[model samples]
Target: MRNVLVPLSCAALFSLGPTVASAAPEDGRPVADPSSSVAASGAAARLAPLTLSVAIERAMSAHPRLRAAVLDVEASDGAVQQAALPPNPSLAFEQEDTRRDTRTVTVLLSQPLEVGGQRAARTALARQGREVARADLDALRAEVRADVVQAFFSALIAQERVSAATESLRIAGSGADMTARRVAAGKLSPIDETRARVALATARVELRQAEAERVAARHALALATGQEEAAFVTLDGGADSLPGLPDEADLARRLSDAPTLRRSRLEVDRAQAAYELERARRFPDVTVSLGAKRSQELGRSQAVIGVSMPLPVFDRNQGAQREALKRRQAAEAMAEAQAYRLRAEVLSAAVELRARVDEIDALRRDVLPGAREAHAAAMRGFELGKFGFLDVLDAQRTWLQARMQWLDALMKAHRANAELERRLGAPTQQP
Candidate 1:
């Protein structure tokens, strides 16, 4: 288990592998977090990679948070029907005794009629709450999707690192073999062969550690995908390759629709509906009663009707109305804050993404080719007795490190894009 939070709501913090650190900004709150890329290299290719959407869909379907949100919405929907129902009627029976054989018998029925638009207001409030719950469900889906995609990329990086470590081990073994041949032929010292063997041993240790990390990363991905047993599923994803960058200008336009911001706005709307309902409650309802009165001895019957109402002098519902108004105001303020944070996040991620793209390009075009050529030349020179064993070792180490850096850069670029999408409250591109 890893102490890292990701997706929009810190959902994956508990299950990220040992290598994952929760340093990325969540939503629009600017935490000075580092990028979530790991140190790794390109190596063994995955046998069958799962697509990003398949991973996300599997995770979302299994996540209880999204299901809970749906249930909340359904409950809110039920409230609407409850709100629309009218007050039930009441019935009463009465008997009065008089002197002698005279007696009076009465039967009455009363119905309370709702006034001041209270019923309509209550229904509106319930409907608004449903909207808010539905919006929250939408946000939940987006967050889960981001988490799965990022985890897939992390696992992919781990596998590549394992391959790179294996490659390094192979190089070390080759150096040791060459040194032994030279020592036998009286060309190199026995101590040189011992040094080569030591390097090979170190490479073997590194390869084992790298393989362990890959296993951990894969397990973490399985957890994020909500596989109950952490099954060994080879995740195949295009997340390693950089997707086309979104237009920065278009991101601003998309802000209004961002899931977090949308939920905030819905909160405001729901609060306003509640406030209106409270205000509508200031007036009292009217209850009308009808009865038949009978005098047994006099053999007479009479029809009677009466109306009743509550006086507002005792309580005008002023306190509740004021509270509702304040709540609505608070919701509006929160919505504004979320908007500001979301806009800032988009700008920040965009700048970071561009810089990473340039770095990756430079490493691919100018750095890697030269490092490879240098290592190759050193190897050839050593075989021809023009270079020392140390020279060859140094060249190989430099090339290995350069490749690792390149891989790190690539992973960082992918993370920047995923963070941007998470903050956007929706997927910017199909994974």
Candidate 2:
């Protein structure tokens, strides 16, 4: 059996079939490097076509959502830096007795010391927060990659549909021309010629609709790639370029390390660290002061030292500690729930991918060949005056329907594969 599809005779179905490509990368980065080629179309300039890799790379490099996620990571880094800093020291000056000989001045410098491990706990929490932000960035990157892949395939499908419609229009026009000639020669009824014209008109309308859909799909692909306008009019790829699906066992093996689950786990760690930091706050920090005092009356200088600390009276961070603990619990629950949901989704996508692959195989191997043969036979019989024009129309419709269904199956298969890769956290090798 052919892996892609067989071309029909006059209809030329699957002649320009859609393609699928890998959206996930092995190293968890964007699929391909960005290229500076393929600029937006000018008034008379023809833009170069884009490959799937270029489109994905452009999205990863320029997509606003990804930039926002990177900013979150940078913000978390700032928080970590702030958390590591020691408390600022205070300098105080006092003056008393404005009389000439009774004037006294004292200079005091005090520094708060973190004796309760609050700095360590705070810094740990901030680092964990940064990890959570990084995880979020990774998750967002994976999502963007999948979105680009889906949009790319959608455009490819639209392109193929326009080709199919154009072929149908040609076939319909040929049938109409043949019927009109036969009617003029008095070998066919006037109604047969009318029916042929109606089919031709319908084909024209279908072609127009398909062309519109292709335009919409191109716009969607541009948006997905973070472009302000559709930059390229064509895509570079071939049919059946998609990687094969891994078995259920492989998907199960990759489930635990999914990006979403990793983010959720990081959230739990951050919440636990926050709880520790809050508990550390229950012990008040101490301030130590050291300075020199000068007396105008005595005409001498003396050194002074003192220490102070809060008694933790009435506010031992009880509320904050409780909140942090509750949040930690919530994070744990959420992580568990996410793991469960991800497992289910991966399995579902695997099943869907398998089914679509099988359906596509059946259609190519068993259905399309028969439909093409039937349509060709009906056309021949109609020309020989052994069959009605309606018989030819029915066969043509059946063939068109089969082709559309095959396209639909291919679209679904591409989607399922993209979803499966996204959930797997990384690209799997074809088996």
Candidate 3:
């Protein structure tokens, strides 16, 4: 019968087939594609065409470090709840036999009663630790968002640079063709054609370099978005009007909401709680037990009650209390340091933002228009044979350089705005 049952069980296991694979222990085999799960679950779909804001949000959701911090907060909350609950009671049973051949059995229950507000102290410490964990998570999210925004802007700037380089290359190629025709007709010297060719080659080299930069920027954006494919990344937004700047008083008020400062404050609270918990440990906890007992020789039964408490003999947690106190002091010092640093960062970023805004305005009002006028004048003079080819080339170069500079300035202003928003803990413009 046993042999038949064993065979039937074996047959049943064999029948399970691939369904049993799920219950099998992992064999330490690497997955064929690490991104297969992300591919199938539409994670890639969500990111396949990502905007800047979407990319930041995706990073905040998917970055493993940020997710771990969030999970730590949840776990700390659970720990706090556990710390608040009273200790569970213990149960015991006993039996004794004497020389007279009599037997006895007994059952007992015991519970350790915490004294000196130990449970309360522990709960407070755990709750404060949980608050610190929550603050840490918030700080991590803020930092990650800032990084993603910067990377997205960098990618956009690189793409714009590539476009500018391509345009420059096209213009240079056109100039080279005209110079070649002039040389063939004996209207321009062969040396002029050679100069034009050299300029075209330089332009082509710049284009290639710009293309490489764009590729790198795309990869950076993909990494920031937690996406493996650059084709999925996109930037559909442009810089909007500058945001209104807050006054010093208003900025000071806003600094209280900064994630880093808030995290530091929470750390101070946690340290204080730890100090108090250690101080409370100077008092001892009492353990009480009750039981029933029987003796074999006398054939008698008895009830027993016992109490035990630790004596504060050599060590009294003095060292631990001192250490915790020092830690609390250190946390307070750290909070002050963080506050000062935040103030300096905010002030510096604000100053830089205002400067960028001024620069952008100046470029719009003066530099760009002046360059355009000069370029137009040079082009007309060259057509009338009044200006030399070098003069025309110089004017064209100056105009292109000025335009590129303006673009760079605009990118700087955008980045400054982002930094200010990060410092002030506020929403940025669409850009």
Measured by lDDT, the strongest candidate is 2
Give the local distance difference test score of model 3. Answer: 0.79
lDDT of 2 by residue, 162-213 (tens): 9889989999999999999999999989999999999999999999999999
Q: Global lDDT of each model?
A: 0.82, 0.86, 0.79
Clashing pairs in 2: none
TM-score of every candidate relative to the true structure: 0.81, 0.86, 0.83
Candidate 1 segments whose C-alpha is farther than 4 A from its true place: 1-49, 60-62, 93-107, 184-186, 228-232, 292-304
Note the residue pairs that clash in candidate 1: 4-13, 49-236, 50-236
lDDT of each residue in 112-219, candidate 3, tens digit only = 998888899999999998888888777777667666776777777787788879988887887788778878988778998888899899989989998898889778
For residues 99-123, write the lDDT of model 1, one tens digit per residue: 5468888898999998899999999
Cα displacement (Å) at residue 119, model 3: 1.1
The true-versus-predicted C-alpha distance at residue 397 of model 2, in Å, is 0.3
* Clash pairs detected, candidate 3: 48-232
Candidates 2 and 3: which is better by lDDT? 2
The model with the greatest TM-score is: 2
lDDT of 1 at 352: 81
